[model samples]
Target: MYRGTDLPSDGLIAVVKRDCPTCVLTAPVLGDFVQRTGLAVYTQDDPDFPETVPGRIDDTMLDVSHRLRIEIVPTLIRMRGGQEMDRTYGWDRAEWERVSGLTAIGPDLPMSRPGCGAKNIEPGIIEKLKIRHGETGLASRRIELGGGEDEIEAMFDRGWSDGLPLVPPTEERVLRMLSGTARDPQEVIGLCPPDLVPATVEKIAINAVMAGCKPEYLPVVLAAVEAVLDEPFAMHGVLATTMYVGPVVVVNGAVRRQIGMNAKGNALGQGNRANATIGRALQLVIRNIGGGRPQEVDRATLGNPGKYTYCFAEDEEGSSWEPLSVERGLPQGKSAVTVFAGYGLQGVVDQKSRDPESLSRSFATSLMAVQNVKLAPACDVMIVVCPEHERTFRTAGWSKQRFLTRLHELCEISGEELISGAKGIAEGGPDTLAGKMVKKFRPGGILIVRAGGGAGMFSGIIGGWAASGARGSSPVTKEVKT
Candidate 1:
C-alpha cells in the first residue's frame, strides 16, 4: 500500500502477515528500524492475525490489502523518492539488509527472533521497546546542578526557600533513604495539601533522608504521614493557607524514650537530634513530595521557626496526670504520635498559680485569647502545660478529664467576643451547622495537654485555625509497634 511521503529523508516500509512465523520474526526487527530512523512503518497481516501483537485491527490490514496486492506472507519493501523500489521475500539475513539498505543494525537492537515472543525478552531491550511504543515513566529525576553562578542564584532568587543553604536531593541519596521503608517504592501514601498531589512512600523517605533523618526515625515520619492524611487534618488546606500554621508533632509512650525525643527544658527550641530531625523530615516530605515549597503552596505569612523542626515528647514521668496519648484514647503502654497544624506558641507564665483552679484559669484564658485571634472557636488548640503546672492541678485532685472540663468551662467566650475581626473565623452569615458550632463553642473548644519539664511554671499555647473549610479537630493516634 502506498501512503504519501511528506518527509522522504525519514521514512521506511515493513511487510508481514497473520499466522506466519517468519513474518512475525521480521516484524520486530522492522519495527526497531522504523523507530530508530524516525520513519513511517505499517504492517500487512493476514486475516487471522494473532492476539499477541497489540493495536492490530482487522480493518486496517484489510484497507491496506484492498489498496495494494500482497501475494507473499513475509516481504521487506523499501520506499524512497515516493516509490517502492526494493522488494524481498523470505528470511535471508543478507537480502533483508540489501532490501532495507541498513548498513549496520545496532548490537543493542531489540528484535524478536523466529521462536521468541515479547514476554521472553531481556529487561533493557523490553524497556526500549516499551518506550518506543510510547509508555512513560515517573518524573523522578534530580534538578540539574553546575550551572553558572547567575543561573544558580536565579533559582534561589525566586523565593524557593527561607534564605538558608539547602541539601540538594540527589537520586542516589533518595534511593538509599527509600531502602528503609517496607512499602513499595511506587505505592501512593496520600495527596499532599494545597496541590493535593499524590506522594508515594518512597518519595517521602527520599525527602526525609535529604532532611538528615536517621533510618530509625522513619516510623515517626510514617506516623506523621498518617496523621496528616486524616480527613479532618486537611493537610492540603493547611499547606495552602496564608496562616503560619505548621505541623507540630508530639511523641508519647515508648517512642519518646526509644528515639530520645527531648521532653524537658528547651524541648521546642532545638539542639536535640530526634526532636529536630523528625520534624524536619515531615517538613521535607511536605516540601518535596507534597510540592508545598515555601512561597508556593506553603503561603505562610512570617512562617514560624517551628516550620523547620517542631517535634517534642510529653514528659510522662514528670506529669502526675495521664499522658496526652492516653487521654486521646490510646493505651498507656502503646507508643503514639500527635500532629497539629498550628501557629507560633504563646508562653503562659504562671508562677503564682498553686491551685488547680488558678492554673486552669490561666491556661484557659491564654487558650481563649489566642483562640479569639485567628482560629475558629470550634477549632482545636494544644496547651503544653509544664510539669510544674500539672503538679498543682494533680495536688488539687484534678483528673485528666476534670482538667479538660475545667479548661472547657473557663475558656468559654460570648458570641460577641468571638465575632470580632478573627482572620479565619467565619462570620455569622446564613448560619450553617459549622457556623452555629463556631458561635456555640467559642473558646471552650480548646484541647489541653500536660507536658514539659517539672521546674518550669510556664505553658505553651499552640493556636490553630480552620483549614480547607473547617478545623481538623480529630487527633489521629496510631500505636508504634515494638
Candidate 2:
C-alpha cells in the first residue's frame, strides 16, 4: 500500500534495462513499437538504451519501476483508461505482441529469454529507494550539517549525548534499526516524563542508533523505557531526587540469550555490547525524546555511575532458582525487563558461609545497610547473588522463595535500637518510646537476581531510592515485545 509515480492512461509501456541480455535483444523491437501507437519505453539503466526511440523515460532512480510493482525487466504492459489491461515479463515475443497488439515484435530474437532482477528489488536497495521516494513515513526533522561539521561532534553539540560520543543517527542507520521491530515507526509508545513529550517508535530508533545498539537490542530498550514511563515507576521523581539512583534494568528470559546479553562474569561491568548499549539507549531516549537532561529536570546531588547506563541479564542457566521476572509475576521463558530505581553496587563478600542458613544471615546483616543500618523500612534492595554464593543455597535445596523468606526473617530487629539517639549517631528511625520489632525493609521490598562470575563468592547489592512502594517508585516489569 505505497503511493508510487503515475503511469500513462492509454499506452503500451515497455520496461527494460541495458544490463539485461533479454532487454538488449528486444531493445530494437521495443524502439519500433515506440514509433507506432501510444507506446512508451522506460529504461532503467540508461535512457539511450533504445537508440531509435524518440522518447525514453529514465527510471534510473527506480520511481517508475517501484510504482508499477516491476519485479523483472523487459516487462510489457498495456494501460487502458489509466487501468492495467494486460502485462507480461521477460522476452516472451508472443505474449508481448498480444499485450501490445503488434505482430512480430522481435522476429530476429529467440522465442523467450529470462529477464534480470529489477534494481528496485535488489538486496538492501528497496529500503534506500523507499527513503528516496518519500514512502518511509519517518517524521523526524532532518538536520543538514555544514560541510565542516563533524557528525560525531554535531550530536554532542546538540546535547544528544550522555557525556560520551554518540553514533550519528543517519537515515540509513535509523532505517536499519527500525527493521528490528514489527511496530510502526510513527506509533506513539508513551509520554516521557519531566517534559511529557510523546515518544514514538521512530524517536526510539533514532536514540538507539545514537546509543550504538544493534537492531536486535531495540526491544529490550523499548521495554525498559515503557516500564519507566508507567505511573508506578515514577521516573520524574527518580530524576528529581537527590539520592544516587537510576533505572537498573534486569533482563530475563529467552531475549537475554537471543540478544547475547552478558549474564556471566562481568555481567554488571563493561565488555558486553548488548549490556552496555541497551542501558545507554534507554537513558538516551529519556534525554533526547523526554527532555530529561542533567541540571534541567535530572537534578541529582551525587548521581552514581549507573545513571549513565545500568543493565544486565540474570544468569538463568547457572541458577536453579526461579528467575527475577518470574518472582515479579511474569511467566518463565517469556522475555521481560524489570526496571528498578537502584543506586550503585555495594559488594557483599562472604567467603565463609557454607550453608543457606549461614548465607541468609550474612545477607540479612548486609541488607540492613540499604538506606542506613538504623533506618528500618527505608528502601528496597536488589541482591545480585553470584554463582558461588548461589551454589551454597542450591546445594541445600533452597528455592528462591525460601531463601528470600529466610533473609526477611533474619532482618528483624528491636525498634528500641532504631529510635533517635539510640545508635549514638542520632540518625535513626522514629521513636515513640520504641518497644516493638521493626523489619529492615518493607514487605516485598527486596529482589534477588543471579549474576556475576561463576567462581566468585561475592554478591552485589544495589540499594533502591528511599522512596519505595506505592508512593514513590516501584520496580516495574513488562514483557519484552519482539
Candidate 3:
C-alpha cells in the first residue's frame, strides 16, 4: 500500500508518457473516456501527450511516478475513496474494455501493446527525484541551496571532496545504497580515526553513494571499511605519518565475481567500476566520516594516486595457489576483504627469467628496493604476481610455498652492508645488528596474491608502511557481512 497523502477519491487515473507508442495509440480512447467520465489523467514524460484531453497533470519531476511505484508507463488506475480498487499498465483491448466499460475501438488498434518504462526509474533521475520530493529520511544535516547556488561548487566549498568531483549524496541515493545491507541504519560499525567519529551504517552508505558505488557493491565497501577500522590495522597511524602509505584492499572469494570486480588486465589501473568505487568509498569514509583530510591529519609528504583508490580482486581461477582469503584463515568459498597499509606500486619487470629460481631471484632483487636498496627487514611487502609469471612458476611444478621460501632465502641480506658508517648514511642499522643476516619478511609476513592480465611479464609490489611487528600496521582480514 502507498503511504503517500492526498490521493484522489473515486476517479479514473491514466498515467502516460508521450514517447510511449502504446500511450499514443490509446490517446484517442482516453480522450473519449475523459469526455465520458471526467477522468483525472497524468502525464509522466511529456505533458502535451493527448491533444484531446484538455489538461494533463504534469509528472515530469516523477514525484507521483515514484510514490506509486510505477514501473511501466501508460498505467490505468481505478481509485475509490483514496484507495486503489484496480490497476493495470500497458494496453490490452479486452482488459481495457472490461475495466473502462467501453467497447469502442479503432480499426488501427492492435490486440495488445507493452508500455515504455516509467521516467522515474530512468538511470540517474530516480535518486534525484527521491531527494527533491523529500521522500527519504536522511539523518545528516540538510543543506538548502538557493537558485543561484551551484551544488558541485557548494560541495567543493564545503570541503567534501578528495581533490575530485563527487557524486552528490542525495537522500534517495544513500537510501538505495543502504538497501544492500540488512543491518539497522543507526548501528555503529566502528570508530573511524583522526577525529574518532562513530561510523554508522547510514553514514557509510552516504559516503558510498558519494563514491559512486552501486548498491550491490556496498557490502564489500563496508567490509573494507571495517578492515581498516580494526585496531590491528592501525589506520590512524597509517594516515598520520609522513610515509607514502594508504590502505590497499584485496577482495577474495565469491563476492569478487558477484560484484563484477576486475582481476584481469589493467586491474590495478582505471576502467572497472566496482574495483574503483569500492576503494574510493573506503577512502571517502576515512576523509568525510573520520576527519582525515590532507594538511590536517593526513600529513603525507607525497601521497600516491592509490590514496584515491587501490582495490583489486585476486585471480583465483587463473592461479595454482590457494586463494588469499583461504590462506589467511577464511573458510573456503566465503567472501572476505583484507586491508593492508600499503605504499604504492613498484613494477618488477623480468621477461627473461622463465624458471622459478631465476624469477624468484629477480623478484627478491626488486623487493630489496622497497624502502631502499640496503633496507632489509624494514617492512612487509605485498607481491602481486602477474598471470604470465604465475604460469611460468606453475609450469615448472613450483608451489606457492616453494616460491615464497625461495624469495625469502634470496632476500636475506648481510647486516654489514646495512649499517650506517659502512654505507655512509646519517641513520642506519644498529652496531649490535651489524654483520648478521636479516630476512626480508618475518614468518608469514610476506603477502602474495595473483592478479593482472596474461600478457604482462611484469609483477607488481606494494611496500608496507614500516617494519613488520609492534611498530607498523598489520594486514586485517574481515568477512563480508552482507
Candidate 4:
C-alpha cells in the first residue's frame, strides 16, 4: 500500500495547482525561490507552470499533495530530514517568506488571497486518495465490482438492501462515517443477533454509510445498535416472532436537535434524513452483520412499514413532561436512544377534549383495543403525545406521571368482562378470576413520549409485542456517547 512520498532531507517543497488563481499570481515568486534557495516545486495540475523555472516536478497525480496533507493550493513547506518543519498557504507575504527563508516573495500581490481548496479535499476525491494512500485500516472484506456491473443493482442482488436503494458502503464513506465518534473503529460493542456476529464500531459505521447517514448521526446509530442488542431488549426474539413487530427507536435530549432530527410536524413520517437513516442503519447492521433477513431469521408474518425503518425524536422542548431519556433514568441534558419492539402505529383523535380527563379517556379507549380489547395485560404500549394533546394535560396541571397513572386507571376492566366469550369476542383472558379488576398494562408497560406537530390534537400509540415484560422484548434505552 502506498503511504506517501518522502521529499529530500532539506529543502523547501512548494505545492501549487493550475486551477488556483492565487497560484497563478504566485508563480513568479516560485521561480525566484527555486533560483535563490533549495526549493522543489510540485505542480498539482500542470507541469508547464512557471515557464521561467526548470526542474519542477509534476504532481498532478496528487500523491505528494495527499502525502503532505495539503488542504489548499499554493502551499509552501520547509522540510527537514523528510519531515515538514514549517508550512504556509496562499499569498501571505511575510508568512511565505519566513517559511521559504526567501525575502520579498509575492511583493506585488496583496496581503493574501485565500487559496482555492485543494483537489484532494473535493467531495469524493479524498476517499480515493485515502484508499490509494492506504490510510484506512478497515477490516471488512473488499468487494470490487465488475466494470460493467451496476452498483445499485449489485447490492440488491447480494441481498444487502431492506427493500430500498442504499448508499454504497465504500471504504472512503465508511472511514468518513467513523470520524463521527472517537471510539476505536475496531472496538467491539457486543455480539449481534441470530448469527451472533461480533459487532465492532467499524462494522456499524459501514452500515451507517450504507444507510445514508451523515457522519454526525453515527453516534446515535451506534447507541441504537447497542440498545437493541441489549440482553433485555430481546432483539432476536423480536426478529424471529411471527408477530407484525419491529424495533421502534425513540431519541431524546440534545442529540435530537443536534442531528437535525424531526421532532415536530411529520416527525414520524418521511422527509427527515436523520430520522430515516439512523433507524435504517440499525436494521442494515442486523441484516448485513447479524444475517437477519425477512424470510431468514426475521420471520415477521406481516411486517409493518416500520420494518423498513421507524425512528423519531421526542418533542422534549415542547413537551409538558421530562425528556423521555430522563424519565428512563438518563441524567438530564444527556442524549440517549430507546428501542422498543413495536408493531404498528395507532393514532387517537380527540379534537374536543379541552381537559386532561377527557383526552386521557380518549387515549385509553384506543390503547385498550391494543392486541385485543377483551384481553387483559396482553401487550405493552407506547403513547406518543402530540403538542396540542399535551397542552390539555399541562393546562390541567397534570404531570407525565399523573397522566400515565390516570391512563392505567382508566384502562382497568372487570375480570368478568375480559374472560373468554364475555363480549362475544373470542380473544379474551383466562377465567381464573370470576369477578375482579384487571389492569390494561402491567407496571411500567405503558411507555409515553411527546411528539408530532403543534396544530393537531392527536396522539399516536405504538402497541408493543404481545410477549411483554420478562417474557419478551422490553424497551431498552442506552446513552449516546462520543
Q: Estimate each model's TM-score.
A: 0.61, 0.81, 0.78, 0.88
What is candidate 4's CA lDDT for residue 473?
88
Residues 402-441, model 2: lDDT tens digits: 9888988988888888888896979886777399888888
Local lDDT at 392 for model 4: 88
Order candidates by TM-score, high to low.
4, 2, 3, 1
Enumerate clash totals for all models, in the order shown.
Answer: 3, 0, 0, 0
lDDT of each: 0.63, 0.88, 0.85, 0.88
Q: Candidate 1 regions off by >4 Å? A: 1-139, 142-163, 168-176, 371-378, 415-444, 467-474
Which residue pairs clash in candidate 4? none
The alpha-carbon root-mean-square deviation between model 4 and the true structure, to one decimal in Å, is 3.1
Candidate 4 local distance difference test against the native: 0.88
Candidate 2 versus truth, CA RMSD in Å, comes to 5.2
What local lDDT does model 1 show for residue 181?
56
- Total backbone clashes of model 3? 0
lDDT of 4 by residue, 29-147 (tens): 88888778867888887899756568888878888888888999889888777667899998899898788776776677888889989887676677778888787888999999999
Q: Which candidate, 2 or 4, would have the higher TM-score against the true structure?
A: 4
lDDT of 3 by residue, 1-482 (tens): 45566446677888888888888998987888887876767788777877768877887877787877788878888877777778888998877776666576544688899888988877567767767777556678877877999888888888988878889987777878987888777888899999999998889999899889998998998899889998888889999988888999999999899999999999899999999999999999999999999889899999889999999999899689988898889998889998988878899999998799889998998988888766667688899999999999999999899999888888888888777676677456777767699886777778999999989798999988874546768899999988
